[model samples]
Target: MQDVKADVYVPGHGPILKGASALDRHIKFYKDLRNIIKDAINDNIEATKISVPDTFGEPDEGRKNMTVETWLKFYG
Candidate 1:
């Protein structure tokens, strides 16, 4: 918010919000990403949480890789 001096913002997967609601989605997004990556790691398809959409940092070297859909199912 500081970057834009704005009070509200819309998250990637949810609706826009102007106050605590915005914060709620932000936190959930992080938690969701965490679970997603954890599942990937458990399944041996390494992944990590990140700020930007489809923009995770380097994941651990793995023997195989998969599509985002696969990750979502694993994550869900």
Candidate 2:
């Protein structure tokens, strides 16, 4: 994404994101999420018990729980 320069990004869901900073924020969000999940796994936290932090910027309760469940299936 950093290699591809664009004025705007059209995601499959959500509103259109504008500017390169949007990409940066997107990348950071994923990185932070990955780190959080990895840390949870290391701490022996149960997937069903894990909670998404507010800093993740994901507001949808269903989506947040689904994301953690999906990642747990893959990385837990």
TM-score: which candidate is best? 2
TM-score for each model: 0.39, 0.76
lDDT of 2: 0.78
Residue-wise lDDT of candidate 2 within 1-76, one digit each (tens)?
A: 6787899988777667798988777777778778889989999898767776665364687887898988877877
Clashing pairs in 1: none
Residue 6 of candidate 2: its Cα lDDT?
95
lDDT by residue for model 1 (3-57), tens: 5545777657555767765566666655766666666667776333322233334
Off by more than 4 A, model 2: 11-15, 53-58
Candidate RMSDs in order = 11.0, 2.3
Supply candidate 2's per-residue lDDT for 13: 78
Q: Which portions of model 1 miss their true places by more than 4 Å?
A: 1-17, 46-76
C-alpha lDDT (0 to 100) for residue 66 of candidate 2: 91
